[model samples]
Structure formats: structure tokens, C-alpha cells
Target chain A: MSIFFSLFAGLGLFFIGIRLVSNNLRQVIGRRLRQLIARAVTGAGSLALFGLLAGAVMQSVNAVIHVLVSLVTAGAMDRKRAFPIIRWANIGTSLLVLVAAIDLHALALCLVGLTGIAYYQQIDQSTRWRHAVGALLGLGLLFLGTDFIKSGAALLRTEPWLRLHISELGLWLLPSFAIGAAVAWVAQSSTTVVVITMSLAAGGLISWNGGTMLVMGAGLGSAVSAWNLAGRLQGSARQLVLFQVLLRLQGLLLTFIFYACNRWLLDDPFNRLLDHFQLGLPARFAAFYMVVQLLSDLGSRTLEKPSLRWLEAWAAPSLQENLSKPHFVHDEALDEAETALLLADKEQQRLLACLPAYLDALRQDAPAALASADKRQAAESQVLQLCEQFLVELADRQRSRDVLERSMVLRDRNRLLGSLQESLAELHQSTRAVMSDPTVAQLLDHLVQSLHIVLETLAETAALAQPDAEELELLRSLTHDRSDLMDSIRRRLQGSDLEPGLRQAVFSATTVFERCVWLARRYVLLLDGPAASPDHPK
Target chain B: MSFEHDINDEQGTRLVSLKGRIDSATASAFEQATQDLFATPNARALLDFSAVDYISSAGLRVVLMAAKRAKQAQGRLLLCGMRQHVREVFEISGFLQIIDSVADRSEGLRQLNA
Candidate 1:
């Protein structure tokens, strides 16, 4: 009971330590991880090498693979680079097995003490130092936990019933293999299973052949674990996990054939080599594990190309893949300031193109109920919000004076357009309530007709390279005339015996109408240059 | 938009208080409510614009139209309690030139009766 308690406590502490280190390290790295991948990794070889280093530093190949998956999803790295990186990350898992084999309690304790003092002193106030300390603490806890697990497991040698059961199971390779695989799956760490198998074999409880079968099962167990995990993932991530499973299966097949053929070989050359070297069973088992890993990685070199092709072909991106990405932002335009400005201008024009459609929606006959009008307004708001997002993204780009000026104009224009649309939507809602008032209804109809004219002129002028002075004058005159028209409507309503609600409806509709013309005039002035602005008053 | 009008005396000096947004939609109501004030006997109109939040060009045009009519009737159109932003709209559109403005109701009445 004590042994079982210690074992579970150790496993719990191990998982917590790993999770703590991974999460904190990710925060410490933050966006620099993407920057590092961009700068340090160029080709497949470098990417693989970097992946190995990242896995070793992070202490979890699975964690490293998840980072790669995120990078791919963010469109920060291509799938081609991710494939090699994933391969090397898988190779890097061997480091954990190697570390677990040797006792690092003393070194881990030293690091813990050093980081503890550093943390106490607040030597570096940055999050980077804090994360480093956390990682050291996690490493120390992992070392301590492993020691507890090993000590607890050592007691199993004294239990005769367990030994008898193990011996009975060890008589058949398949059952022993399955038992090893099952243990690894439960622990979610094949390294733990391999270490236990090595300890059992070295203690003279399990034979060398039984240890080999257990190691073989550990490989399949890892594959099963990855497949179970990858089942929930999509795109390049799922493909990489699938590839990992296939690679493990390949290793399992090779190991099984070697085990079967060794029975007929003279004196079992593998065991003879371990005996001749006077190495312990633990070292011998570790050596076999590494050889299998190396062989699999080497064999997988030829499979990489076809595997990547298959992944790409199978996980063909959907059309909506681009929905999350900015449609107007092209990477090539970012290199040149002028080109970027031009692209932003084009994007602004695209937003303006939506103006006609928005106006058309407003011009349509009133809906049957208030709820439908609200729904239509909500949908229109979302579309306008998307345009605003795009405009904001464009505004964030670095630009020179000319481009900067243009961006400012476009940003202001976008804002005013959004305001105008909001007012129009409000007017539509009020128009519905006041539809029974013939005076209000007629005024709304006339307002809508006038708005259409203003919008068409604005849209046409936006498309021109330079709006002629006469055209600019005409727009300004129309703006003045619209203001007068609204005033006359106000005067007419004031002379009538209309109810307050009907009068208020006409006022709100006229507000949007006058502002639309004002906005058009402002935009025309913006195009005509700062000197022609109404604020300056030509 | 709303209009709260009070007749100060038998001489018919009217105090008209406006609130909320006065744009094209509400301008008609505003004009309708205030148009009759200037027509009253011995009428001197004082409009309070402090609570008004915004005025589009349409609203400014109504103010200008009222000012012109008040002047024609030999009645004063005095605006008081204008919010800074709303006042700026009036100033920018040159509506301040068309109507007399005072700081508050007392000042507006003093100016209108003067």
C-alpha cells in the first residue's frame, strides 16, 4: 500500500512538473518563439536541428510539436518546414529516456538551490528570469519524484506473488508486450515504462528477452498515445500525429522480426555483446531502445516527401481557410511603403463599394415587423465591423508622409461612413414606427431618394483620379441644397398639426440625410486637397 | 428631440427649451414647435440649447430659417445655454451670424427684451 501511494504521488508530481515547465516556458518565450523560428530555421535540416534543441530545452517533444502546430495555424510557418521540425522533435524524445536513465538528483538539486536564491534576490525582474526559475523548480521536482518512484518500484522485487505472475506473463512475448504498452499508455510516458522495465531486468526479475519485448510494446504505446491525442486535432497537426503513429508501427514491425529471428541465431549476438561489455541490463536496454529510434528516424528520411505529399493532399484547405486571414493585406506590398499605401487605398475603395449595397438595403421597402428590422441592422453592423477591422489593420502599417496622409483621410472617411450607417439604421427603425404618418412617410421617401443620389455621386467621385472642380462644386452645391431641403421639410412640419412622434421621426431621418451629404462633401474636399476644405471655407 | 415652451408674460416672451439630438429627423418637430412662438403678440423668443447634444446641417438650417423669419416679424430670436460642441456647429456653419446668442436664459431674455 505504501509503495502504491508513493508511485501515484510520484506520477502526479511528475505530470505537474512537466505541465508547469511547459506552460511557463511558453509564456516566457511568447512571440519570440515565432521570431526565433523565422530567423534560425531556413531549410529542412536546420528546422529539424532547431526542433531537437527546442524539444530538449522544453523537455517535451509533444509540447514542441504543439508549438509547431500553432505556428502553422497562425500562418507564421509553412507545413513543409513543420514536417521536418516534427520529425526532429520526435527524435528528441530520446533525450528524456537518456536523462531518466542516469540519476540527476544531485544536479537537479543544485539547480533548484541556485534558482531559488536567484528568485529570492529578485536578481532579474523580468518574466524571463521568473520562468527560468519555475523551469528549474519543475526539473528539481521531477528528479525528486523519479527517485521516489524508483525506490518504491524497488520493493516489487521482494513480492513473490508479483514475481510469479510476471514470470508467468513473461513466458509469452505478446502478453508481456501488451502489458508494457498498457502501462505506458496509462502513464502517458513511454520513458517511465522503459525505465521500469530496465530496473526490473537489472534486478534479475525479468530476462533480457522479456525486457526487449516490453521496450517494443513501449514504442506502440507511444504511437497509440499520439494517435489518441491527434484525433482531436486538424490539418497539418493531425497529419504529423498520424505520421508519428505510422513511424512507431514501422519500428514495432522491425523489432518483432528481429526478436523472432534471434531465436534461430547462434548464441544470440545481441546478448553476447552486452555480456562481453560487462554492462548492466539497464544500459543494455537503453542501447537497444536508442538503436531502434535511430533506425526508425533514418528509415523515415525517405518517407518524409511522400508523407508530406499525402498530408497536403488529404488535408486540402477549405475555402473558408482564408476567412480568418486578412484578404487585402499582401505580403509583397509590405516591403514597399508606396505599394502598401496603394493597397490600403484599394481596400478603402472596396469598403466604399459596399456603400451602394448598404444604401440599397436601406432604400428597400420597410419590413413587416420590428424584429426583422433589428436583425437586418445587426447583420449590417457585422459587415461594417469587418470593414472597420480591415481599415484598422491598414492604418497600423508604417507609412511615409504622403501615404500617412492618405491613410488618415481613409480612416476618417471609414469612421464617418460607419456613423452615417448607424444613423441610417436608426432612421429605418423610427421610420417603421412612424409609417402611419403620411407626412413622415413622404418625407422619408424623399430623404431616401436624395441619399441615393448623394451616394452615387460620392461613389463615382471616389473612382476618379481627380474630381474636376465643376464636379466638386456640384457636390458642394448638392450638400448645401440638401441642407436647405431638410430645413424646408422642418419648416413645413412645424406649420402642420403633426404629433410629436411623427415630427421626431422626420427629424431623425433628416439628420442622417444632411450628415450623408455633409460626409460626401467632406470626402470630395479631402480629394480636392486641404485648401478646398469647408473648414477653410473657399 | 423635445420642446418645452413657457410664456413669460402677457406680452408673450417665450422661453423654449430643446433637448436631445436635433438632426434632420427631429428638425421638423423642432421647427414646428418653435414656429408658432414668433407668431404670438409682442413675441420675443429665447431658445435654450444646453441639453441638445448634436445638430447636423439640417438642424442648423432650421435655426437659420427661424432666425430669418423672427427678424422679418420684428421679433428677436435669442439662443441661450448652447453646449460648446453644438455651439461650434452653429459657429462653423455661420449660423451664429444669423441669430443672437446669450450665455443663459436670463441673459437671453435681457438681450431679447433689450
Candidate 2:
């Protein structure tokens, strides 16, 4: 087959292989992997190393970051801690390209083929084999893309117009860096960008230096994604994002200088030794990129806190958006304290969106989720503060008694929502504590669900006192139904071979739900128009 | 005990009646009783926790799943025949809000029958 045709075939096969691998492996080892990530440290060095490894494994830096971001938001790690992990992720990702550029197609093909068989092997025992295919598919895509760039470059060896585009290497570096950064930001996968650049280099499409420079530029670009995710969180979550941006910016500055000096120092003997002999241009470039990446990643890892503090000093004043004033939620409005408060509320609403999920999560075992439990409480407190702020403003504006009642109901609901998160967190902890007795441990997931259904029902009905007969009927029946579930759990708690911690979490969740119902009950009283809290009668 | 579940999609109700106890051990069976349809009624479901001599979160999970399933379908989950203890379970634990509970199967029959 022609080179282009071969390249296309390889690329297609490669992607298919990776899809199969990721899925199968995810099935086989998803929990172990998630636990490892959840337990990862806050320091940049370790995080970056993990990133690198994940990037290397997936051969997609952007994909790793995306996964990391999702994990972080899901409370696998504090957003504050994701900074260095991202740094190392980049370094690890670059290695894929370096290996590919060396033309290790045979190794790539073998791994992809064996893993592909395991993936499509079609047996219950080999379920994990299916995910192995996802890994290979990624590798295959890497090779196929590389092959395309190489043949394309071989064609370029004869094409003069593109050659005319080459002599301006330094000028090209500037644009390519910007281009790589933009592409990485948009595609959200640094590996893809680097692979493309590597393909161009192996094909002799871009000069050796051009491809290397772009790889470096890709590093700067990958940082933007972490910034966006961190921006998506509340409080420390927001700070974590800014910290990531600072690390990336410093790395970029250093990279830019390195890129600029690379051309001037091309004639240096050490570089000359790297360029000539069996080492080759791309290999030398790879070595240089590796050293530079190690330094920048390590530097960012060490200096992230201090460096971000510096970046914040300069950038905070220039930020224009404020969450407090109700601008769109995605505004660059990072630093304003007033807006930050409002932003926190938006985050709480977002958390509310996760109520069902939280309910599901709580029904399981949660040994690594203590941090998430803490975060849930913090978010609820912030929401309460926001409601209080809004309430104070409403009272000052002379809002009506009915409006005040509505505000109180809303505030109470918000508090209940927060309590639910803690309850769920505790539920998970309890489930783990009692796992030895699967019967009792398994019961906790159910108990939490029973509690959740009630909270949601109240929210749906709004606990209006004079609720229509249908509403009353519905409420009475579901309440009774849930009571059935609770009784069984209590019995199990009383008699089962469960741990003390497990028993306590279940008891606590059961209690919180009951109290929330108490709030909902009073809410019904409020529909009596100030009759709910007679002491503060209108 | 034999259990039969009928889903009235257009009417928005999942009617499940069981001849056995609805306790932790049997809840999974209760849930499987209606696995054929995830969300009840797209708007409402009728659960007969009556044959349920006992109920637990395992049963509540089935209820919550049904509730979530019903809510997503833009319907409602209406449960009935929770014994006094069952009634207390929903009351003290607060599963009532997320699910609509009634006194007996007749109440659900009346609600859905109408």
C-alpha cells in the first residue's frame, strides 16, 4: 500500500484499539485507579509524575487532564492539589511522541495487536482484556498519525513551497507555539497536538527544531484546561485553578526563552554531537525537550504556591468579572470578594444538581471520601451565608412577611441539602466500616436512598400547609413507605454484625433526614401565613 | 412469594404487588420485580409495599430508583400499603418527600383507578 493509505489504515486501527483498551482496562482496574488518584498528594512533583504516567499510558495529555479534572470535581482530589499533577502529565505525554519519532512501530504494533485480541476475545473471565484494547487503540493512533506525518514529509522533501515556509524557523516557532497552545486548549488533548507535531517532524514536514518547539508550546497550552476546571469550582477550588495557571505561565516563560536560544546555540558542540552520528535530529530534539520539560515541571511543582502568589498579585487587579453582581457564571471574575460570595452560591446550585448523584454515592462504601464530605459541608455553609446575605438585603429593602417566609423556606431547604451531603458521606464511610458483613453494609446504601427520596419529595411539594388532598395523600403514603425501609435498617443496626462506625453513620443519616422533615413540617406551618413560627408572628 | 408488576406507561403508574415480605433480603427481588421498566409511569408509579411484611433501604433503593425513574419520566411514584412500622420508617427517616406514600393499596387503586 501507498504510504498515505497505509498511514490512514494504521490511524484508524490505532484509535479503535485505544477505545477497546480504555474501556476494558477501565472495567478491570477502574476502582483501583480511581482510589490511587483520589489518594494522590498535593505536591506538584508527585502529581506531575502521575500526570506524566497517565499521559504516557493514554498517550493523550489532554485526555488525562480531562479525566483528572472530572475526578477532582467529583472530590477525588482538592482542586488545590491538581496543579502539579497536571505539570507531570505534560512531561509524561511528551514521551509518547519522543518514542514514536524514534520509529518504534514494531513494538507499538505488537502491543496493540495482543491487547486488541484480549479486548475482542469475547469471554467473561477476560473482561479486563476488553479495556486493554483502549490502551492499544491509543498507541495505534499515535503510530498511524506518525506514519502519516512521515510520508507526508517524504512528499514535502520534494515540495518547494512548503520548503520556502521552513527557512524562517524562529518566526515559525512563535506562530507554531501559539498554534499549538490554541489547539491544545481547544482540543483539550496535548498528546494529539504533540503527536501531530512529531508526525510532521518524522515526515520532515516541520524542521526538527520546529516540531520540538511546538511540543514545548503544547505544554503551555495544556495548562489552560486545568485553569478552566479550577475556575469551575468554589473557594479553594477556585484558588487551585489559579495556582495551576501560575505554574503553567512560569513554565511557558521558561520554554519561550529556551525556544529562542535553541536556534542561536545550534552550532554548539554538544548539540552538534546530538545532531550528527546515529543520534539524529529528532532524537537530539527529544533529549532537549525532555530536559527542559523536567526542569519546568519540577520548577512549577516546587514554586507553584509562591509563583502563583506572584501571578495573582499581577493578574487579580486586571480581572473584571464579579460573581456577586450576577454577570454570566463563566466570567473571568476570579478575585472580587463580593462576586466570589455569589459565585459560591452558584456552586451550591451546581451541587444541588448533583443531589441525585450524591444520593447514589452515599449508598456505597466511602473510605477515601472524608474530604468530599468536608467539601459538601463547606459548600452548604457558603450557601447559607449567601442566603443570609440576600435575606439581609431583602429585609433592608422592606420585603413583605410572605416574601420573608419564602426566603426562610428556601434557606432551610438549602441547609437540608447541605446536611444531605454530609449524611451521604457518612453513609459511605459506614458502608465501608461494615463491609465484612455484606448484608448490613449493603443495607446502608438502601437506607441513604430512603432518606434522599423524602428530602426530594419535600422539595417537590414545598411543604405548603394546606396542600391539596392529592398532595397530602401522596405525602402520607411515601412517608409511610420510607418508614418501612427505616424500620428494617434500624432492626439490622440493632442485630447485625456491623462495626460501631457503620452503625453511627447510618444512625446519623437517619437522624438528619428526620430533622430535615421537621424543617419541612414547619414549612407547612408557614403556609398558615406566619403561624409556623408564632413567636415571630407577623 | 410470587410477585407481579404491571407498568401503565400511558397512565403513568407502575403497579407492583407482592405476595412476600418486602425486607432487606427480598428488596432486591422487589426491585427486580420491575427491572423491565426503570422509571415508573413516566409520571407516576404505584408500589404495593403491603405484601411487604418488612422493608429496608434495599427496598427504598428500589423505591428511590423508581422515584428517580418516575421523575425523569415526568411522572410520580405513589406508594401505598406501608404497615404502621413501614409508615414510621418513611416518617422518621424522611423518605416521604422523594416518594409519595398512601395508606393502602385501595388508596393507590383509588388514585390510579380514577
Residue-wise C-alpha lDDT for candidate 1, range A348-461, written one tens digit per residue? 555455454444444433223323434444544444444454445455665445555655676676566666656656666767666556656545654664565456556666
lDDT, candidate 2, A160-187, per-residue tens: 6655665454457677777667656644
**Top candidate (lDDT):** 1
lDDT (Cα, tens digit) per residue for candidate 2, span B1-114: 433444454344557765554544566777776565543334445777676555545565576566656655676567888777666555545566556778887788678657
Instruction: Choose the strongest candidate by DockQ.
Output: 2
Assess every candidate by TM-score. 0.52, 0.39
- Model 1 CAPRI quality: incorrect
Proportion of the native interface contacts kept in model 1: 0.00
On a 0 to 100 scale, what is the lDDT of residue A346 in model 1?
A: 58
TM-score of chain B of each: 0.85, 0.74
